[model samples]
Target: MADDDDEGGFGGLYEDGHWIWDDISKSLVFVSDLPPKPVEAIQILAKAPTGTVEFRDDVDLIEQIRFRRRYQRKLKPGQEDVITVQDVKDIALYTAPVQIMSPLLINMLHLPTTERFIRALILYSAYYLQIADEMANRIMELEKKIRTPDCDILEHEFRDNLADLRLLVAKEYSVMLIGGSDMRKFHHMGPAKKRRSLSDKDARLFETLLRMCVQIVWLALGRKSFNQIELETNRIFKSEIFNAVEHTLKTGYINNMAKEERVVLLGHCLRYDKKLNTRSPLMNEVFCHRPIDYRMMGLGVIKVQQMSPRLHYMLQAVAGPEEKLSELGVVVGILGMPRSAFDTMLRPLPTAVEKSKASMSSTSGHSSSKSTASMGKSTTAAHKVYPDVVLPRKETRELFYPPSFPDEPEKIRPCSETQRRRWQNRLMKLLHPHR
Candidate 1:
């Protein structure tokens, strides 16, 4: 029987046998009719490498297998991937570039609310820095043009562009400050319902963001204007908000300040005291207190309320039938949101009452149809077609406008001429300061 088995198995010591060469062992081995176990097959394959394999040790091989399998593991049903600190950092760094930053930052707003605040801080900081660099470059160009003896007239076009740029910067600064306060409140009373302090990394990022805010303000409004506004804010708040801000602006470092001090300083920056009036024309325009409840409009009630008041006002203002001081395009451009998205955001959501009413009407209509059918009455209701009132979607034509430019030029006279005169006066003062 053994002789017969050996002859049948091709010199193997197995019943119903086959023979296979073991490349690693460099010998013939008997293959059983039953297949090898997965582990055994893997070991055999690992040992009998056809080519050079990087994993030399069993531990390394196991680690490689785990690494590959890690990505393959699927989440359980209804399980959401949690956004960790690392994820936020990656997003922040990815959107740090100037060219791609704005749109990406705008998109971050659509992230899960849990992650939005931190992302907002980091991305907004980077954005502020980008705009600061741009404003600095523009200012340098204007200065160079002024110094040029051949350049006699400060062109309306250039001045207009600078003014618009300044206005954009101012609006952003105000929005940042207001948004900061909202973010703080949000985190403190987050979904967890626990007071969450910033991690060391987040704290550092927040400090840098606050510093950039100060820099943005300083650059947008010149030192003179900045000083006047700071003094007024100090008087109104009776706190060292702007003083700390000035120090941060000048030093470009907040490491010296304690965390509590930094927090207080941040609070001051984001604080919008109704009585507080900077009195400077530009400052007043930038930091106006017009508290409007967006919940009434049923447009992102919670999210919008938790956002910057100015931003809320801007959204509301743009949704108006009559064009307001801030154009939808300008707001959209400043926020880096696409026109379509901005319009969608402005679109009102139906209230719970309206939804219930709609359902009730639908049910009643169905019941009425059933009864009408039973009665054998074929009465069709006449539907009235109302004229569609198209809301004018205003698009910005020029890259720049006078500071006082309104949405509708026809309805409201543009103060471009006055702005031009002011620009000329400013240029004249720069040229002959002694006079």
Candidate 2:
């Protein structure tokens, strides 16, 4: 509180480093030796603006120059982080879910294999469109900095092209797996042996196209991880089918076209199933056996359920059982025999085999002594390529349902009561055939 003096409305009220000079309202002024800390400055460039100059101190000038240089460096060719290895490792994105309709699509969905390919083609197109749209959007944003109007026309064109592509692919695929002599072959073949009927060249070509589509989809969508795809490719390459193909190719036994057309179809199926869907069917969990006479195996030579009917019959004649006997009646039963006939045929074989087992075991012991000698001698080649089944494990790791991902510990899919009972019945039939 202050009382007014003779000549003063209010004399300057001096405190620590400031003086209050105003009377109606208090205002303080201060002076200090320490200079204020420099704050970082940001400046936005104008769109299509005439060149303008700004005045700034040494620090601000240096900061602006450095920012400009960094921006310029980013615009340089081959400097994009998106295409770099380190960025790929860090980002690790891939294409999303796709249902790889089995090659047996005709049997399973009553849809042609070409229809499934078209679906996959649509997925690939989706990926391509997404990438194009993203790039277009980025360009639009960048162009906005240079020119204010939006790229509405470009956006519209992209959308139209995408729609047209989908429609065109769908329409074209409708006729691809049907009609013509070449196409009729595909339709007439058994669902299980469709791919087998193809010349190696055709198969490989189809596989290559599928592989490319899958690869592109993954690169664009970033759904699955890179490691999963790589492992799948490696597994495919190491398969017996690949080996057989390679062996024949090297020997010139397989034509160049057939050699090129590979069985990468199953690999893709496995990839889509395991990496994308939990309910993926066990496509590769199939068994094919051939009985041979040489190894003291009680059943004489026989070939079972081969992909090629011609090859199956050929091998049967050359190496199959001399006597025409239904070994376990499995083949005949599987061929849709009458239930009563199947039951009647199934009995007594096990007892008969049991009685012969003791003699076979003693002979098998003798054969084991000569196993090393037999190992060097080549047995007739009856190769049944089950790509998903590893040789070391006779059975699949996932019995009823495929795992959605490799890391998934649970092997079984959650099923309805009916499905669970159906699986139980099948398992019982398989494991305890006598029952």
Candidate 3:
């Protein structure tokens, strides 16, 4: 490996040719596609007099532009290609992250809904799904340019199928049961009489759907789950959210947060559950700062959980079970009840009418009126807008844990003694001057 040799010292291919690892060319690399890609980073060899190497916006000149990929995990002996945790986890150079928290978080840590997630829309909704579709396609083209030995490529492979995935998820939760003349016809019949709606159950289930969507989107964006983080992290996220809410309730101020803030908080909260040490302010902002996303509708519906006595009685004021319910009708608003109570109430009643109505447009009622930048796309808005139980699947594909029930918990484990000494020396280098 001579210095002048440009043949094989980690030379990666590019449109112009190949770039040797040690080659100090005056070039910059721009990394974008913020979401879902763990390392949405930009770096370049700054040819300035200082000759610094750092993030740059130029694509052509940059020497390296590796994407955070999601591909298959490597397996153990006799298990070639078997997906292991390392193959999935190691797929990061760097990327933006949001904090996530779920009481159900630990229970279903390994198998979050990401595998079965469907964020789709119809072809007619050109403006909405078109750009998304193009983005997905462009990602595929870029993927071919580079190949890492790890697994983030799997997530990259998912880019093209975003639209159809949503459709498939809708079909999974379609929950339509029909027989007789209604079922026999080639032509379609009307919606089911008894179906999921706000009033059919308590607000929690409705809210859970919203929470799940946010969690899913957050997960898709590669953020760590909050409950899975330190117990303190979870506390911080909730505290921040509540504090922000309190500010709004008491005074009038706005606090907005980024995806990173969420992840940091969740991580911090879980970091010191035993001690409850000082929390990260970033988490405070996220929990409280209202992200004006379509998920808000689901959040609002979920908000039914916090309903004052007046709101609860108001729901009861609605007409009898036989009455026709409008979109925001009582049936759609019963999101606060506990699952058992909600289910018990619906044991006899009919489900929401599963009308094959054309999809709702412009808004899915999940978004808050205040924010323009909402959840993933329009389709997810309507998907969770209508009430549904959306229980966690039995066989979740998440690599870390199983679905619903977790097996033995595994600690991340400490670095070895030799590795610890090397780590300490490195840390000391930045903090302490030479002897």
Candidate 4:
């Protein structure tokens, strides 16, 4: 570790050649090499006044002096950005992700322990879940208003509100996905020495929060099937959440676990997958039905139900008698599986038509048509049957007028006296909620 008062020291665990001591794993890890700095002479020359007859050659030396002075006043850890539990709670209640999530995420990286990180993650997931539920309710309300003939909300107002809500949902979901990816990356880097073992209680709560995140994601996608969500949302989901989950399942931070513990952990992963499959049939067909050989268990096959009792007991102990696991939402279920298992499970299986085509020299057009028809049926089945809040078939002109020009300010209409009174009452109600 570098001394705090040492001049030109890298500070903390950082050392020369981009190597840093990982206190948690008790090992030295290689950080990435620093980006190349521009040559001082060239930079100084480039910044010289245009077409100058004479330029000061000592500018580089002067710049170096200034840099050294600024470097001497480097911020202590106390001066760095800090986020508190209350700050996160307040942000979740009052602000949109667009306004604060990025800075909040950056500050969370400076959190000192695994427990604190998990707590922050849980708060973020809860915020996302709340937003998703609200959006769903708002959409339902909008649908009712659109159907009511006497509704006073103009077409433009309705469209603009729906667009704003959808945009908000997308932004919030993106932040959540990024946060989840960063959490997995941080965990994979090894735990901080101060908080080596995650408590079983925190672990279970983290798992529940992850499940809630998945459910919120599904809700944001309009509760559509995987295939139906393939267009806009699928790419983002796959790139961020799917990739993060896949990577974590493959290379977990379990280097310190004993052999028996590893086996039990693997069993838990399989058991969770089994339970999850029961909840999502599509996932069951995609990943759980296939047989996987666990080399950690000496290439032995373990039945999905073999570990059920132990997992149930663990859940029961953590959750107590009154709570149901189902209330936590959909399980992300593959967090602890090995990389080989994940790859095998994700591999696409060939259909009967493709198998027959390989055997024959040429395939009949009938086979292609039949496959297309089946695909259409699946698409239709996956598609939302209800009227979409976003897309309406009937096109109507906006009821609101365009903005008035500065020269013709009289064209700008003022709010009606009734509308002004209504807004005043609403503001008063907000100010005095109990009243």
lDDT of 2 by residue, 1-435 (tens): 355453656756556544555654565455554668985232222221110211111235454454334211132364322121111111111111112212222121122233233333323233222323243334435545653345444444443333322323333233343423124444433333444343443343334333433343333222232222322232333333333333432433112112111121121122233333322111221111222111111111122221233223222222232122123211210111121221111212344434434544543322111101111221111110000100011122322332431231212212123322333343345446898
Question: What TM-score does each of the candidates earn?
Answer: 0.23, 0.18, 0.19, 0.18
lDDT of each candidate versus the true structure:
0.29, 0.28, 0.25, 0.28
Error of 2 at 218 (Å): 3.4
Separate clash counts for every candidate? 0, 15, 67, 0
Clash pairs, candidate 1, are: none
| Clashing residue pairs found in predicted model 4 | none
Give the alpha carbon lDDT tens digit for every residue of 360-424 in model 4: 32422221111111112222112221111122222243323226312311121121233223333
| Candidate 4: regions farther than 4 A off | 1-166, 173-213, 216-224, 227-383, 391-435
Report the number of the highest-TM-score candidate. Answer: 1
Superposed Cα RMSD, model 3:
28.3
| The best candidate in terms of lDDT | 1
Error of 4 at 204 (Å): 9.3
Can you give the lDDT of residue 143 in candidate 4? 43
Model 3 Cα lDDT, one tens digit per residue, 218-270: 22222322122112222222344433223433321112223322222122212
Q: Can you rank all candidates by lDDT, best first?
A: 1, 4, 2, 3
Q: Which of 3 and 4 is the better model by lDDT?
A: 4
